[model samples]
Target: MLNRKIATSTAAVALLLTWSAGLTPAHAAPSSPAPTAAGWLARQLVDGERLETVVDQVPYPDQGATADAVLAFAAAGVAQDNATKATDWLARPQTLAAYLGDGTTESYAGAHAKLALVAQVQGRDPRSFGGVDLISRLTALQAPSGRFSDKSAYGDYSNGITQSLAVIALERHGTAPEAAVDYLVDAACQDGGFPLYLEQTPCASDADTTGYAAQALLASGRQAEAARALEWLEGVQGPGGGFRGSGPTPQENANSTGLAAQALRVGGRTAAADKAVAFLKSLQVGCGDAARAGAIAYDATGFDQGNATRATTQGITGIVGVGLLELSAHGEATAPASDCPITTTTTTTTTTAVPATTTTAGTSTSSEPAAAAPVTSNGTRQLARTGFEPGPALALGVLLIATGVLALLLARPRRAER
Candidate 1:
């Protein structure tokens, strides 16, 4: 009787163990949601629209007005690669001054910088429009500690908007300004993200600040540091294939995503770069009127009703143009036809001008015209263009590293508590 009772108990225990094993699979964690194209599309629309509005309203000239018209046309030409139109616009001094005069000193400086970029691309001397002087003023705006202060009192230091603008100015003027990078790096928090300025800073790194920082650094020639900042950026990307400005908000906005993608691409993260491109494409509303299509609206579905501005227009144009350029360079985007011109307008004149000399790393090269020459270093060639550079990237990277280390250290105690 005892042996029989023991056998039954053993069988009962085996049955219970089998039942528990069966329940384990059901209690397992849920799988991560797959990334959706729609989510990416939504982010693009918001960013595209905001960018479009900014580009549209910045007071481009009426068609017949020589000066403003020229600037207006030039601005449009840069977007569309219309060299003929750009030249026509540049041919008129009054229009140029009018367009250049629309903003305060800061905005004018930005306009000149943009013009200088277009000139650089067309193999023209950027200094013709007082580009160097403009850069100097932009640089002068920088505080002794390397931080930039907007002349406007209402400007928020935390946004780092002026600094970003300064980065563009410095880049177009053909030199990487280290002061901005130093200031930004000094202000970096313990996290891989930057606070707007240095106070009332966001809890997590902001997408806008991070994106701008990444651009500045990459343009300045600090690839390794840019890569580090990008790695930190990777952590901020939402599952939706878009990044949030901060916190739990997952609104997939365009400005952040567009800028972020550009930064990642410049930093050499091909996969993430592809994802960002896909996201931007998903946001495209197809070519239509400024109100209907050219404007990058709030969602891929096209619901936002905001007015267009020059800033958005330039941002979109730069992203699409530069993004395509980068992709084409890597053979990811289609190669342009031999007859295809990067600029949209046709040139009426064929002037083979003398080449200007340039000094890089204290070494001067005189093989080609300054406009047509390529500055090569470490297997990377840079055309004289108004963009971000490596100095900011290095500074941003230093900050990111410091922030990441702090985050890890702080996380240790939390894990221990748990």
Candidate 2:
């Protein structure tokens, strides 16, 4: 059970113009003349009035992406009605909370955390959304080391996001997260950007994990660490003001740029944030395809060769600097992390503990975590997470923003979409 009280204090939604004022960098990046992201997104709704992965693929609404779209609307101060519909779709029991990973303890940690944050920003009960208690479920999945993923899934897929989203969701519920920040702090690469998992050795850092980790630390009030991370993360930005995905590929894209942009904005790097926003805007699908005009692309070529649904929704998050840390600023006193450990531990002898096991979000255990799924050789495995392909590919898939980057790199869209 969640050792916290869910809060429901409603604040009048602010207009989009000033939505990012608080997070705007001291040195704003070069601004651009762009369409209203919220209004553009609002036009892509399907007949059900909910945001779909592609409006044609999967047919059903994407709960996680829908939550992201709602938060984006809230951030932009437009399309409250459509945002409301997306929220309603997520709040349905048969949707995000109920169907993702089919109730697995680990599979949908990111989705649940993000959905709870949507409720948090709306001043609703994230714990009792559609009779599903996301806070409690997320809390129950914490591992002994304070990580949130199970071992059975792919690499850092669940843990990194679990840590990031948990900080925000639990705060809205008025309960301090019991997981120690040490796990995320330890996950940082030498460059200060965090990896998909924890590590002690030198490894390359990634924008996605680094962005989420920075946001998680900020929401948790670990400002010093957040500051250091923001610096290292800024180093990865390319000349075009975009950040790269995890791995050997230094290519810039919306998902990574969005994540890094949100992190930089909240962490007090306005110039970096502004530049990232500009880069993402340049990726929006425009003029050519009327059906996808307002949608965001995964990367430069995505507009011509990729699907826009997931990338567009997530892209809006970075563009507006929408995050739980920002939301926490509006509510009453934010929830602090609990002192006692929140992860579960079984009785095992010290000797047997040598080959000791560690658990992840889905209750799956691993013999050796490859010494944490950092940017080492094991890093490649981090890109193979199953379920919910995101990014450039337009596949008929379910939900999992464990970042769509992995999907973009590994899977090709097999089915054709309208």
Candidate 3:
């Protein structure tokens, strides 16, 4: 009888273990880093339409930032709907008026070039964007020297960013002008990298300018020059694989690192590219916070909401190993959570049995069982992030006295202005 009782207890325990296994919830699988970041970024958009920049307690539509967001969406191969909405918002007449000017007194070479690329990526006709001829307008701004200049009284702020953009846009449209291609090639610094400001003395090379210039060169069939530029980039890459802009005291940041990584990958530097992706992933918010999980921080200092928009937007390209020229949207619309480190917890019931692993937003390693967090039906954690999204794509103070001032400032645009 004693033996029989012992056997019965063993059988009960086995049955309980089997039953518990069946009851264990299937944890959500974490998404790849690219989609993970892209998903979080898609949520950051205000009303899923645009990103707004505030100046002097006022909000204006940030077309530059919005354009970057579209490119980010396309590069990640996710968030096609959001990309479409953003492009549509950009194509709005009022929005175009604010960004590209009314064809007279305020046409920006950089704005036209950047928006033309954005329109092309969205499968929209750049020729007829917002009832404006982007191609002709952009070409019209090209000087005799082949540099695309801002044809406005405010002065020319066109730099390598705008020039590279113009070349790529024109190349994609059909054929890049010979003069434009030559101008881009001639702008290469002595170090084989390109300068952000072509007019800057000594022709100091920076990662941001070199990255775009390399891509533009490749697009224009200048393989030899592009190779030289990529070589220079390989030299400037930080030991940890991050890159900083060209400056007296450059500190590694996501924006420059992101663009450099894109160029390296396109230049066929696989080993270097992998290192860059790893470096970018290191900056990603892996676990702990549900809402900020997939967001990539600006640097080692950690994630800051104020700077996260540009950081994540540019950073995802490197994470996914795509360049601006090769970006497109063709994946599922659903945003996936990042694959965070697994957290194991034990639950005590009638028997001291360990529960199956479950998916939790953010990384945690607490031994104590965590209470269940609310999840949507499809399993995405609801975002707690809110308010106007900032982008570093455009910077302009609002003033009616000089509406054209926006275009003038746009001539010399920054990649991070929003």
Q: Report residue 126 deviation for candidate 3 (angstroms).
A: 0.8
Model 1 TM-score relative to the real fold: 0.49
Q: Which parts of model 3 have CA positions greater than 4 angstroms off?
A: 1-31, 247-249, 337-418
How high is the CA lDDT of each candidate model? 0.42, 0.58, 0.74
- Native-vs-model 2 lDDT? 0.58
* TM-score ranking, best first: 3, 2, 1
Each model's TM-score?
0.49, 0.63, 0.75
Where does candidate 2 stray beyond 4 Å?
Answer: 1-35, 54-60, 97-107, 150-157, 198-202, 248-250, 285-292, 302-306, 328-418
**Deviation from native of the Cα of residue 359 in model 2, angstroms:** 88
Q: Which pairs in model 2 have colliding backbones?
A: 25-270, 106-361, 106-362, 149-360, 149-361, 150-360, 150-361, 390-404
Model 2 root mean square deviation, Cα atoms: 29.3
Q: Which window of ten consecutive residues has the lowest lDDT sum in model 2?
A: 3-12
Task: Name the lDDT value of residue 399 in candidate 2.
Answer: 22
By lDDT, the best candidate is 3
For 133-217, candidate 1 gives per-residue lDDT tens digits of 3444445556687766545434523245345545654665566567766665655556666554454535446776676676666
Residue-by-residue lDDT tens digits, candidate 3, 314-367? 888776666666665666665555555466653423332223322112222233
Candidate 2 lDDT over 31-111, as tens digits, reads: 211224455566666643576554444465556666766676666555666766666777776675344454553356677
Candidate 2 clashes: the total is 8
Clashes of 3: 14
